[model samples]
Structures are given as structure tokens and as C-alpha cells.
Target: MTNAPFVVMKAVAKRWNGQLGVEDISLDIDEGSFVALLGPSGCGKSTSLRLLAGLEIPDEGQILIDGRDVTTSAASDRNLSMVFQSYALFPHLSVAENVIFGLKVRRVPRAERAKKMKRALQITGLEGLEHRKPGELSGGQRQRVALARAIVAGQRLCLMDEPLSNLDAKLRNSVRKDIKKLQRDLGITVIYVTHDQTEAMSMADKVVLMKDGRIQQVGTPDDLYNRPANTFVAEFVGAPPMALIQSSVLGGFDASLTLGLRAEHVSIVSKGEGQLSCTVSEAEFLGSETLIGLSHEGTVGLSVLQPGLALLDEGTTVDIAFDAANLHKFNQEGDRMSEV
Candidate 1:
């Protein structure tokens, strides 16, 4: 028989008073894999992480970690470490002190704590800055201190709640790579919560996208990008998102259906030479390319990517073309249709 999942949340749910927090959540995670709980604010991603970390007991269903049912276990009883978005470091404590505080509280011997602290500091690249207090360090350095603390605990599973959110864009990118590398080197399972799709798409082996206290989809980055489960996912997963057009606007398809396609699949052709004619709504220039937003009578998120800098004027008429095979069809309820 095959081995069981390293972690499982079986129909787990939570609520406050009469309102829903998270409902009917079920998932399986493999060992040493990075899984990201991703969604917008109030989408229950953090609540789900709290439930898995034993910070919030589930109102329904069971949670299993390493084959043990910990649905009702206390947070202390679960062998997992947590890093929060706020860093949660004591300003008065030096980096070394903060890193080993958990071990000290657990009554680990002084010598052993020192050994663990040393390795944690080395791994997180904070060896020279160990004597500095949290207030004395940069935002990124303080966050690393929190990571060092988690490392020193020697837990096989770690939960991080938007640990990079406080950092600036550049620092977020830097620490994002650091956290992914740290998780890989330690061979630990990580359950991270984030509102940013970029972090989830870049760092996670699997992504569980939630909305309104429920899961929308769970799959690899590629699966969520190329084969979204529904319209919400199709519109939310990409940078520019997939452009959707009513099937009535196109021929050879059911009028009740919606058609989805990406900007990369759309090309600009000479006037009157393409499938659909649209008006330019806006043009945005990135470093390497420009995106031209298009407006048609029955389409949303319609756009085409132009190489270099091609700034089409607003209200300029353009013709865009795409292969029929690239179209993704959806039903009235927004669910994807199977390939025909």
C-alpha cells in the first residue's frame, strides 16, 4: 500500500457566531513540500493556516499531521513552528537570544541551545548580527531572526503567515527567495498563507486558492495558470488575467458559453484582417514589453502583448487574432468545460 499523506485537513471548518470562517476544506500535503494558502483579504487563508497550526481548533472535521489526529490538540502539543507577518520579535532581545528563546523555554540544555542557535544563525545568514536587537536590524534581518527561531526549534513542519508582506517590493523579492531556499535546505514541510499570487505561484509546490471561507481550487502553479477550474481562477491567477468574451460575440459556439484566452495568444493584425475588431482602451509599458488593453462590446480583460514599446493611442481601432484551439470555454456558472 502507498504511504499516507504527511498532512491532511478533512472537511475542516470554522465559524464565529453564525457566520462562516472556512467551510468544507479538505486537502492533502506531501512531506517536505511547500504549500501556499492564497486569497484576498477575508478569504479564510489565514484561518485555515491557524487551524493547521493548532492556533484555532476546527469547528468541524479532523486534522492529521504525520498520521496523528490533532484536531483537538493544544498548540503546544503540535510539533510545528510558526513565523508571523509582524516578526513578533522582542525588541529587547538580541538576535541570538530570540533565536534560542523557544529552546530555552522548552528547558533544553544551555550547550544544546547554543549548538542549535549557531546552526540556525548560520543557515539564515545572521551569524555576525546575532548580538543586535530587533530594533537594531533591518526589516529583512528581523524577519530572518524569526526564521532562525523556527529553525532552532527543530520542527519538521513550519507555518508562515505572509512573512514577507512587511518588506518592500525589493526586499520582498529577496526574502522570498531566502525563505524558499531555507525550506528546501531543511527538507521541512511549509504551509504558508499569503494574499499575493506572485508569492504563491513562485514558491509553492501546490497552491490552495480560497474565497469566501471556501476553496476555489488546489493545484500546481502550472495547473492554476494554464487550466483554471473556473472563471474566478481564470481572472485572478495571471498578471493581466485571462480575457473573457461572450460566446455570442464569436461564431461556431454555443451563445450561452463564455470564451477565455490569454493575451499572449492574441496578436495584432492589420485592420479588417483578424477575427475581432476592438478599440484600444489603455496601453501600459513594462521594461521588456507593452500591453495594449482592448475593448469590445461583449468582452472583459481583452488585451494583447506587443514587444518593446508600442503605445497605441486611446480609442484607436485594432484587429486582434487568435487560434480557435486556444479558446477556453466555460458554462454559465463559470466552471470550465472539458476539452471538446
Candidate 2:
């Protein structure tokens, strides 16, 4: 509960077989904040999580927890809990037994273990499932057990690595809320690693985006979406992902470079000054809204967000418009330029 960062990685680097895994990553995670490490597969998000957990040692730099150096400390000495993608529960052990396995290994008395187990089960909404083994529980239930175990570990930090990946879409959405609520209620500092941008944006207090084993951007969800630091971040955080088009293809000047805009930021407008004209390539009505795709003469496509049933037939010529205030510009190297 101090102003000092609860977890710190100073100039961290990791290499494997002459390949760079992660390079010069320095981060500060505050106490009680939920931070997500987001990246595509093999982008070093999971590796970074393991380094912070003390399960893998960094080749360079230091790892500090609560102002104490734990760079080379044993994973047990770090006093942290980890919830994996797999529940990793024992097949024969009951939920209650699995939840308190760590405490049992540490020689905690049965009376105290029972108290801790009860509290953990209550927090995770699995109070009556204690008697059931992993084989007897549903996917969601098993995941909850994993979360409950982390809670009962009574650690200062919790590291969750794609804990929701195995669940179905519906189950993932529900359990995501449950986990976020649980974390907020407990006021614990958590580091979450996930390849799902939706999960990252919806749950994390701060989102740390990585690419090619390097840090890209770190900000709140809204900040990451509304003001992406670079083209990689702008393209990575959105649902169908942000659209990046060459400005020249859209009839803008040669100085225009690359234009970045979210799907919803685009629209169909009257053919006039400042409008980019194209032909309707395709359209998909998704309940309350419609997605209209436009393709220019040279095959440059732009996505337009239109309201319900405002459908346009394919091959219809249309003028594409976007809010000038919302457009982001990027150079050839993908560095962010001022909004044009």
C-alpha cells in the first residue's frame, strides 16, 4: 500500500539460442492495480510474465517485489501465486484439497487451512463444490478453483497467464467479469498475460502491448484505443483491428503518408470536397449496426460503420468520409504522426 511500485523490472533482457526473446523491458506495476501484458503468440508476453513470477530468471536486469530484490530468488520465496491457462488441478483431489495444497505443503494447521479454504471458496462463488474433484467439475468451475487457490495463497501478487483461453466464448465473458470483480474486491496487484485484446482492454487497469519481443505501448484501455502511440498499437487494440491505408491511394497528397482510423470512425458521405470516393465492396449487418466495406479503383479498401439496415448493395459507388478529428497519421516506418 505504498506509493513505490510494488513490482519492478529494470532493464530486463532475455535471449535463447542467439535469438532475442525480450530486450530492455523496464516496467513498474503499482500495488492493487490490474495490469495486462498483451501480445500475439511468441511476442514475449508469457515470457515476461514468467520472469516476473520468479519461475524463470532473466539473463539481465533485476526483479523487485515490494522493494526487495527477488531476481534470482526461488519461485517459492517470491511469495506470489500463478493461475495458468490449464487449471492444472490434480485429477483425484477434491476442490477443497486442491485449493489448500500449497498451505498443506507449508505445514499449515488443518483448522487454519479450513478457514482459508472456506474464504477462498466463498470469494470465488464455489462454496458448495468442495467435495468434487477436477473430473467432476465443468471448465468454468475448474478455472474458478484455480483462481480460488491463488486467492488463498495470500500472496501480494497474482500472475494469471491466459487463464480463460480454454473456456468457450460465453464462459470466457462471464468468468472474465467474475475475475475482475474478485480482483477489485480483494485490492490485490495482478499481472495478467493474454493474447486476447478484448480481454486485455475490458479487464486491465493498464494495458502493456508488446511486439517482436519489445514493448510498444502502456496505457489505460481508453488511452490505448483513442491515442495509440504507434501504428502497431493502433492496429492491435481494436476489434476487427484498426484500418491502416496508404493516404496516397485515397487521393490525398504525397505528404499524407499512412492514415489510421477505427472502423467506427469511418462513414458514408456525399461526394464532395475532402471526401474519398470508392465503390461498395461488401456489407454485413451485425444486429444494431452495419459494416460496409469500400474498395477504391486500385483495390484500396476502407471500412465504414453505418447504423442498422442502412445497407448498400455491392458495386454501388459511394464517398467515404471520416472524422478529421479522429484520424491518426503514421510514417512509412510506422511511427505515429500528429492527427491530420
Candidate 3:
């Protein structure tokens, strides 16, 4: 391979009858790195993945794979593999047949195909189930079969379109680790599409958070969590999300500014002895800690974490304090400000 990046999308844009699919999308994927395209539904993550996969041609810009321009090439010529959200296996085919179908199509020798199938099955823990059809396998097993198929060809680049969406929570967790381990063990590059922040944060080397057909942020999980580029990113990247308070709610700040806060940075103080007074809206016990949601006149998603079973009553007034240094300041347009 050349010294260039493994995959590159330079200002790629896709539209359907002048309706935007994804616009001005540009990204660089390093060899063997896991990059996640993460966003809400209809936010262009899948569209971007499709553009990269050559399933949809871009109206503008170019796509390069390992220094070769493949913008107008057929999907079959991309030299890549894909794992879909729907485990696209033939119902009549046994596990071994399904995994080696591509090899068969390429007219690989019988011995070589069998060796590849055996290795893929071993990597995916499907050795004993080789004779079973898709109808007889569990959802997780079917997904593993799809993964095995994707990797059986030894493609260096793999695109996954929310491959774990069909599995239940526990199965999703198990298969998530399995996929990451598979990618790492084989030294393959992966571009994964997902709307789940947990999956992106846990599995990806980099996250591309998108919204409304645009990339909101591109950074590491910690960078997005700690130094979000703007309010949209600040709110979208976390579970409970960052709380936004009107700057006027606090002293010495412009009314047009918004201040962002995290639950970990907020502390409950004695009544009337803190920065702001809030009403307890609800308390959710999460076994080890209680997530205490609070409401103030000018705050959105205000909450604090209280240690272990500290259930507070609704409408109870509590004082909350936060350090100035821990606050994130934003302009009226919601872009992050360096400091107050």
C-alpha cells in the first residue's frame, strides 16, 4: 500500500432528487483502526456508510481506497466486505455454505475454501454449528455467521451497518466484544454505523458524530465527552447528557450565554447555601447510585448523582453548587466558548 491513508472520502456528497442524503462529508480512516459513524436516525450515518461502500455514488467529491480512486467503481470492485444489520444469509444454506459462498463465487479451490471456512468458523465459535441452517440458529448465532462470512475472505477493510441492532441487550453486549476482538485479532480496518452512543464509545478508536446530514464532531471518545465542539455534541454524546442552564441563572454571565454542566461536577449543598436552588423532579436508583433529576427555572436536563439508595422525595427543594472551572460556556448560537 502507498503512504496515503487506507480509506479517504474527500468532501463526498450524496443527494436524492435534490434532497440531501449527506453533504460535504470528508473522513480519513487509518489502516486497522475502528471508526464509528454515530448519530440519531435519519442523521446521515447510514447514508455516509453507503457512500463509502459504493452502494450510493456521491454527487460530488471522491472516494479512495488505498491510493486507488474508486469513486465511480462498482461495489464488487471495492475489495471490501460488509456485515449488515439484517444478517443476510440464505435460509436454505448451511452455516459452512453461507460463510464460503463468496469464495465459491470467486472459484476458490475446494481445499482452500474448506480451510478458510474452518478458520472463520473457529474464529467465530461456530465450529459445531456448521451443518445448521439459518432457521435453526439463534439470533446471535446468525449474526456470528454473517460476521464469519464478512471476514472469511480476509478483506482488510470491513463496513458494518449496525450489525448488533437485532440482538437483545445481553447478546448485543457479548457480540460487541466478539466483533472488537475479531477486528483486533485480524488487524482489519472497520467503519461501523450505529445510533447508539454506548457502542460507539466502547468499541471505536474514533467517533464521527453526525446530525442533519452534517458531521458535528470527529474525535476520540474522551475528546467528545470532555471537550465537545458545541452544544449539540455536548448533549448527544452522553447518556443523561450534559445539562444546559441559562447564564442569567448564575451571577456575572451574559444572558445570551448558556452554561453546560455534568452530573459528576454538580454537588448538592445545604439548603440556601449554594449557587442555585432546584426542585427534585425524580430519583432513579441505579443500584450503586441514585440519579437525582432536578428542575430549575432556567435549566434543561439538570441532574446530580447521589451515592447509593439516597432516594429524595419529589418537590423537595435542594441547593446545588458547581465550580466555575468545571462549567462549559456556550454562545447564543450553541458553539462552545473557550472560557467565561
Better of 2 and 3 by TM-score: 3
Per-residue lDDT tens digits for candidate 2, residues 213-246, read 8999989999889888888898788865677777
State the lDDT of candidate 1 residue by residue for 97-160, as single tens digits.
9999899899999999999999998998898997898988999999999999999999999999
TM-score of each: 0.99, 0.94, 0.98
Give the best candidate by TM-score: 1
Q: Pick out the ten consecutive residues of candidate 1 with the lowest summed lDDT.
A: 127-136
All predictions: root-mean-square deviation over Cα?
0.8, 2.1, 1.4
lDDT of 3 by residue, 1-340 (tens): 6567899999988889899899999998899999999999999999988887889899999999988999999899999999999999999999999999999999999999999899999999999999999999999999999999998888999999999999999999999999999999999999999999999999999999999999999999998999989999999988689999999889699889999999989999998789999999999999999999999998999999988999999999999998988889889999998743
Q: How many backbone clashes does candidate 1 have?
A: 0
- Point out the higher-scoring one by TM-score: 1 or 3: 1
Superposed Cα deviation of residue 46, candidate 1 (Å)? 0.4
Best by lDDT: 1
Q: How good is model 1 by TM-score?
A: 0.99
lDDT of 1 at 284: 99
In model 2, the worst 10-residue window by lDDT is 294-303
> Which pairs of residues clash in candidate 3, taking residues 3 or more apart in a chain or in different chains?
none
- Name the candidate, 2 or 3, with the larger lDDT value: 3
> Which regions of candidate 3 fall more than 4 Å away from where they truly are?
1-3
